[model samples]
Target: MTKVVLTVDDSRTMRDMLRLALAEASFEVVQAVDGVHGLEVLSQTEPDVIITDINMPNMDGFGFIEAVRRDERRRGTPILVLTTESDAAKKQRARAAGATGWIVKPFDPAKLVDAVRRVAA
Candidate 1:
């Protein structure tokens, strides 16, 4: 089955890049503008994996991950934090909030696809 991935980011360019990369890899892509929008998207679709940016308006990735974790149906879903922040503290914080993995921004397309495949359920 083709995996569906939900990507949440405030940057339109980033969202477009991700959509292109994942779609080229044969994965179905869904997008949201920010964390709040991400939750709204999640309500409408069950994605195999979720990739989110750390910094966003309205709600950040940590808050997004926490919110997802709070929902029993989504608690076990794998979430990958894709951000420009490479800080160890931020990574730890994301892990605490229930993210399955981390990918630094300006990510390589192949590696990003690999990460998604590795974590997808």
Candidate 2:
């Protein structure tokens, strides 16, 4: 089955890039503008994986991960943090909140897709 992927980011460009990359990898892509929007989208679709940015308005990635982990249905879903932030503290925090993996922004499309495949598999 083709995997469904939810990408949450405030930047239109980032979301577009992610859409293209994931779509090319044969994954169906769902987009959200921020963490709040992400959760709303999550309620409507059962995505196999979630890719999120750390610095979105309304709710940041850490909070988003925590919220997803709290939800019983989505708690096991793999969440990959895609952001420009490379701070070790932030990465640690995201992991603490239940992120499955982290990818630096300006990501390599193939690597991103591979990471998704590994986690979603």
Candidate 3:
């Protein structure tokens, strides 16, 4: 089965890059502009895994993760925080918000794919 991955980022370039990488890995990719859009997309698609950027316009990754976890059906969905921020405090915050994993930006496609496979397994 083709695993679906939802990627949320404010950068168009990053979103395009992610789509290319995930698609090359044979994963079905769904995208959103930011955390708010991410939630909207989530309403329609139960993706196997979710990758989101921390800083966004309407809502941030932490808020998005918390909202997702609030939904009983999506509480277990693996959420990977993909962002440029390497702050330990932010990582902890994301973890507390229910993120399953973290990946720094300018991510290695192979490692990102591996992380997704591991978590989505």
What are the lDDT figures for the candidates, one per model? 0.96, 0.96, 0.96
Regions of model 1 farther than 4 Å from truth: none
Off by over 4 Å in 3: none
The residue pairs that clash in candidate 2, if any, are none
Alpha carbon lDDT at 57, candidate 2: 90
Off by over 4 Å in 2: none
lDDT tens digits, residue span 4-116, model 1: 99999999999999999999999999999999999999999999999999999999999999999999999889999999999999999999999999999899999999999
